[model samples]
Target: MSSSAPNAVLSVSGIGKTYAQPVLSNIDLTLLRGEVLALTGENGAGKSTLSKIIGGLVTPTTGQMLFNGRAYTPGSRTQAEELGIRMVMQELNLLPTLSVAENLFLDNLPSHGGWISRKQLRSAAIEAMAQVGLDAIDPDTLVGELGIGHQQMVEIARNLIGDCHVLILDEPTAMLTAREVEMLFDQISRLQARGVAIIYISHRLEELARVAQRIAVLRDGNLVCVEPMANYNSEQLVNLMVGRELGEHMDMGVRTIGAPALTVKGLSRADKVLDVSFEVRAGEIFGISGLIGAGRTELLRLIYGADIADSGTVALGSPAKVADIRSPVDAVRHGIALITEDRKGEGLLLTQSISANIALGNMPAISSAGLVNGRDESALAQRQIDAMRIRSSSPDQLVCELSGGNQQKVVIGRWLERDCAVLLFDEPTRGIDVGAKFDIYALLGELTRQGKALVVVSSDLRELMLICDRIGVLSAGRLIETFERDSWTQDELLAAAFAGYQKRDALLHEAAPRNTL
Candidate 1:
């Protein structure tokens, strides 16, 4: 295959995909060298399906895919890799037991006549790691030992090891820190300089505006629009993706906040969580912000009884009661709900239907006299889907088939349906794109307005700054400081979160009893 023109690395015309039903129809897309094309859509909006078709992970049920003006049909991932097309999926695909260098050089190890060249493999892995700005990670380090951000870098290095012409990244920054995200953008720019056609898929519209040359939107299994990034603002992009104006109506209206709904005093969890104390008032958005591994997630798990806290007191004001909740079921019965950080692992039954996942939270409410009430369950699921504006083919569709944003919504809907008063959300908007993020934020506001106290734990400083009224900063498993919305800046919050631990210790000492000292 050869190209007459200098541009147009890959082209797709009338690309249609179908499984049990139509997943995409008449989708047209073009990837040009030195340019980034962002694919945006809501959950189950056919973005992943389209990407799969391009990467040869899945063949389109209809339409044609062309590379450099030649008919291109990929029978397997190997074929695509050979053709200079590589895709990094949302879910990582690294062998955890393997060393980082081994994983990077798995496909193309330097060899000497049936013998592997260890030195060559290590050198090549180092070069690839450097390309992605991950120089600190030793090639000999185990893949499982690295954080999610480092794992992502390894995936990128794997793609770069190939003669990649078209690079596709799906939700790559979902688990990254601010510094890591900047590094990724720098590497992406370098790739663009090398004339590699990049297809970037993310829920964050702001990122697309910064890095992407153009943006394409998909809805209901159809290509809705494709235009320059400059042509669309955040609001316009969201409207196009969702096919409706997302308004402030999702706000949980203003309500009178009562006494503290939940109070955690002297919470500790081994090395991950130190003595942490905080209070979430009814109808308030109490947010927890810190860098990754700052103990925010462990603290949430302790509150929800997912992980045991060495010692802590949780007091609920509703009926003015306090009790020891040592398990998830106990927390649920006590009007508490937890939306975990790892949605795929903890929040969803990927193989089950949306209805099943939604109904799983409160089974007794949907059941009747030792018999499951199918009609009532269906009705309840339908109501949540409508309320949350979850985009799905049907309530019966498997959750695994939906996009990242939609999956998050399903998890949230599960808790919302149970009418939980104290909701703890961990990275609630982690993998969700920008437009969907706004919807979730609005939904959080609505929850607070309804007198439901929310404690949101997030790595996104901007997200915490925008949605939370009061933010708590944690470091080394300890609560270092607290900031009101007006008093906190991004830099200040970051500093307090990472460097204020000593100050917190001093404060704790001053507050302790003289007899104990």
Candidate 2:
């Protein structure tokens, strides 16, 4: 739908936010009615700050926000909602104890005078859920009973039911399946038809190309560029976002495959992970690529012992059989490390200092007689920080204060300190910028040069193609296929990832039982 008609739906002019230091400066953005504007940048590039300003979660230190060509400043979330603006954050905000229906129309529950109208509320909730392609979830079902993907859908449904004219989604597809992402795109198309201006933010540049008409780039608290999607490719978009050419195909010669460092046999995790098996060779860069919910992350979690496996045997070099690693500590002791996908929630201690977080995994090295050697710790932390090129005010600064890229580096530094022989990185570059991504790739290469085995799980096929020696593809909790780096193109990888290896054969097999019956 073309939004070339007169008044813009939302206009942000000279928007500047200054915390203790400048967060965003002299920014200008416009969202036309029915247009999807993708806001993208490196983590800590002030994109979230800008979104908060629009959603009224934060008041700009300077400048103004105009809605319908009228000066508008929402003092609170309720005010923003009242003004037909709503934000669906990356982190879900649903009450687990409440039913799906209750979470859907939480703000304006249907009521007759002073009494509640439960029946009307459920009907409305169903309608809203239908809009987001989530009709399977019962309205009365407790939110806690739903999966993460379902809960995400509930959040999106809630915004739609609010009759929001302006919708802001921050990293909405970060954890959604391919089918779920398609469902969301369909909903966005419908919302656009109704003249709802959307501010879409995500680390996945490819999705932005598909859904957004215009793209805005932010870098270091400044609006660097804004242009139509027709004018840019993935490479150009990344270049603009990071202000540098992220070198094509990082050097991987440093890591040469040797004997197996770790091996998994018949790994099973109920329905999500089924008879999965893989091996990581020392000094090799192994990658796992799959659509969300394909069991890649789950398999990694099982191997790391973050989650229990009903059946599996893990061998960690030297004829040692690890029966069952019940916890992360056991995995660590076996020289295995897993960098979690949710860096904020699982990987880093945001409130702690960078030095403390970086040194946390290798505390024994700095401890003598149960006393930490402060000087030794500082030196070790500083060495890793310099090597990783972590951009921070100081090692003493809280990790929460660093950019997403820097924080990720801190996490990597922690694992590096442990001198782990095997490392599993899940979405290691999800929220980081292009420049930092290159740095991480280089670090991975360096680690492998030192004979450390690495396994990377990523949603971006291009990343896997560029950095990994071999790639494994998963679909529906099954290990569908594997490919050497030279064996497949990005298009082929994506095809296998989305369509699976034997679609026709699988369908034929499923139909065989029915045909015989």
lDDT of each: 0.83, 0.83
lDDT value, residue 328 of candidate 1: 89
The backbone clash count of each candidate, in order, is 8, 0
lDDT tens digits, residue span 307-414, model 1: 888887787875446668999889988889999866765789999999999999968889988777888878888888887777787888899888767888999888
TM-score for each predicted model, relative to the true structure: 0.85, 0.88
lDDT for each residue of candidate 2 in 125-147, tens digit (9 for 90 to 100) = 88989988888678999987665
Residue 326 local lDDT, model 1: 95
Residue 321, model 1: lDDT of 69
RMSD of 1: 5.5
The list of candidate 2 runs beyond 4 A from truth reads 1-5, 94-102, 109-126, 137-151, 233-235, 389-391, 403-406, 491-517
